[model samples]
Target: MALQARALYDFQSENVGEISVREDEVLTVYSEHDIEGWLEGVNSRGERGLFPASYVQILRAAAGGGAAGEPPASRYANVPSVPPPQPQVAAAGGGGGPGVGSTFCPPPHHLQAAGGGGGGGGGGLVQLTALQHQASGSGGDDDDWDDDWDDNSTVADEPLSGSGSGGGGGMRFSPELDGPGRYRVSTGAGGGRAGAAAASSSAAASSSSSSKSTATVSRNLNRFSTFVKSGGEAFILGEAAGFVKDGDRICVVGGPHGPEWQEDPYPFSCSIDEPTKQTKFKGIKSYISYRLVPSHTQSPVNRRYKHFDWLYGRLVEKFPVISVPHIPEKQATGRFEEDFISKRKKGLILWMNHMTSHPVLARCDAFQHFLTCNDEKAWKQGKRKAERDDMVGGNFFLTLSTPPTPLDLQEVESRVDGFKGFTKRMDESVFQLSHTANEFARKQMVGFKKEYQKVGTSFRLLSQAFEMDQQVFSVGLNRAIAFTGDAYDAIGELFAEQPKQDIDPIVDLLALYQGHLTNFPDIIHVQKGALTKVKESQRHVEEGKMEPQQADGVRERCDTISFATLAEIHHFHTIRVSDFKTQMQHFLQQQIQFYQKVTQKLEEALQKYDGV
Candidate 1:
């Protein structure tokens, strides 16, 4: 029988692998996590996920098959029996409540129950405090940096019970208006599901909090918010631009020729170098930090792989149509090794290069802040501003200045469909190329090296045989044979070294494009979705359910998306040509150099046997 436990406090699911459990809910404990203070269990409803070990009281131990040896009840005896806090709801068409950092108010029914014992239900809102482990050292600017963006602790094999805040209570979940049963968890106050009208105001309020408080409540909200509501239109958070009022409207600004990119005023690049091993909290936690220096600023800032991951997520959220390249994969094991760190730093460099080159992405406020911010206070301020950015999803189109001349919807649809097919084929081709290149690199390192070594070994053995002869003529032949053997051995080392120069760079470039290819389809879909909405609006107009003016507004929005997408597609093509041309040139040059060295060594070996 599975060990059973009862939840003492309401637990909310924050990340992908966690499950939410209400107070008093029974759970079947599957196993304890490698990280202490967490347990893998299935709740009463059969939903399985990782929850805090502290939240549940184990009624029976699996070994004893009865009550736990230690009284579990006493452990949580002092814990409050209050219900979880209900997130503040924004009134429809009005500004939302204060930032998520503000103290949450309990539900009306819970309040009634607390006041009088007869009216409301049993559940009451309780404040769940996350485990906080203060880093050991003089409190300084380092203390203000929030490093909980990624849950790396779960990867450890040893249970870290005493380690500060292994993984609980940073992200919070609140009930969404779409469904009574559905819950929405926001990494920041601006990203939360609230009244659309109040999104910008709420973000401003959220930014007003102190740096430390902002760091504690906010995280990276990197996902696209494209959920379709009961209404035919797509759901969008309130406008991100503070200047744009609730009722303000926008029009396309370019000429009939189509949308063109405004030249980037600040064209600059960034370098990622010096991946240093860093530790905190008296060495309980350790991570690798990269030195980042932007060409525009010349000042260097230290960032971690997680920081790049967070920045990548922000770029994705901020620009849905733009193809954001993925950073290197996160490795759980051997992360601190030199090879892993070097590869990661190189990937970051490439990713940053692309960010700097793009006119639109280069000018992004969040990105600028990431590249330049060195002060702790400024970092938090920039983070909040990025999180609260309202110009995402459908609203992102609102920020674009499209060609004033209306686009032919049919032509736009055709172009979008063609690009969609291109991305699909490109994704498959890149995957195949990446796989083949990796295999070829592996063979060069192992198979080719071994083959050359085998030949060298045979030559050396022949030299030994020649050495046995006492004749003067045999002496020269023996020396030549040994020299040839040494040359072959050197060739074997060259084969092992060759892949790093040519094949690895090709594979890395392919991997980057593969990430871009993956992003393109979604971006195209977003454009196509807008077209679909336009078609729907036209149908409604035909049926007289919607006015012509409303349909026109829909058409304008659709046109905006089309123009932006077309411009981005053009940009992608241009960049693809330039990147492939440069990379292939370098790849071919390296390949030639590798082969020339091999031939040069063989020629020298041939000269050694000239007399023989």
Candidate 2:
């Protein structure tokens, strides 16, 4: 791949001297001196340089930087120096460089630029010169110093049979210097020949260890190997057809890494307290601790991990509804990809977006490993059924979902569109809308019925008491007339002489009626009794036990009248009684015609309604 420089003076410390890598090779710069050790002082090429106040600030932002215009006030210690008045880049269409005449801004100022998605630049082993070593020693290299010094103290090269230690019990060094160019050195512990042998042996041992221990330039080669068998022998798998039984490397893309990548590739483990011995499968040997690294192309496009974390966390805190439980686990080892798919891993949506960028990965067997969780669930159900029928309480076997596989970005795009389509379908579905409306209407009706019963019971009891009072009123009026006939007759005769005074009999009768109505124990007792029932009924309803039958009983006892209907009737009664008294005033008119006519009507109406 062709390389491009990110900044004008991308520098690296090679064995010779500082090398300026400009627009020719992949390069990246770090503000921290320690990164030089890790990257071996290499850099990458891109159109813009993203500035961060501190090394961690830039890294954290790059891991998942916030959306554009978002303030990084807390993570960034220093304010960003904006480029001299240039238009901000739109998030879309490769983040590119500023317009012409723009002066470069320093730390805390982040730049959005276009860069070729070339692999990481070679940060090969650091060439340790004596001067640089003393000034730039990583804490890890301290032990190397002790070991090298110890090696120079050996005395003899005579092999001691089992151990590398010499009979002299000390380190040996061959001291020699080439003429003119190399510095002159000397050996004092043993003979020159023995010192040479010791030095050679030591060199060999160092070479072996360096190969095994020294951090290599992690190759851009993305390979994945899947063990398979063909013709009854072992075979290796690839993105294309399965090959004959020879083990070889197969390249594949990886997923995103969280902010703290150096801490550990996989921080979440299957178990912490439990030993590896407890985690087992019938056929697998050793374990694979999976780590997700973003594909080079996708890294520049989507929101970074750190940004997503911030967004997700902020949303969860602000809106409780977003805090859904049972989110899919990030790490699950020894599990097939198919199993993961069948489990309906929530991340499938995100993973699909990642898959579209790398077409070569579309054919990888690793992709096949991810089992759509739906399929795995169905398979488990089937296996469980068989086990139940056999009644053996024995285990059942089936293939697991595919392993942790990189998704196709194109497929991810399609899946997202599909999800949107599904949501629209649900919204437009007539059955769903109708069902929801029906449920709402049903709940409203239930509430109305409950309220009706509550008020209806009180009215029913009151109506019953009113009817009893009317019956007693008629009986008492008759008895009073029967016992006080002489006095009532005397008053009636005197009132008749002066026709305008006829209202006396009516007023006297009403006064007597009022005395009994005011002191009736029945009215007070019924009102108190109905109130107690109201309280009890409320308790029942609150406890989820109120019933329609109870309401019906209240209605029946109150004469089959609803509360509203009874209220209308009670209002009419009040009007009718008031009108009757007002009309009785006509009986006391100066004209005998009014007095005689009203008296005649009252006697007829009273006799006509005697049974009621």
Candidate maximizing lDDT = 1
lDDT for 450 in candidate 1 is 93
Give the per-residue lDDT of model 1 (tens digit) for 363-462.
7777888888887665765665566554554444434444446789999888888888898888888899889989988888889889998999999999
Model 1 per-residue lDDT at 413? 89
- Model 1 pairs whose backbones collide: 83-124, 83-125, 83-126, 84-125, 84-126, 240-390
lDDT of 2 by residue, 390-429 (tens): 1000000000011122233243334334433543453355
Provide the global lDDT of candidate 2 against the true structure: 0.25
Query: Global lDDT of each model?
Result: 0.57, 0.25
Question: Residue 525 lDDT in model 2?
Answer: 27
The total of clashing pairs for model 2 equals: 65
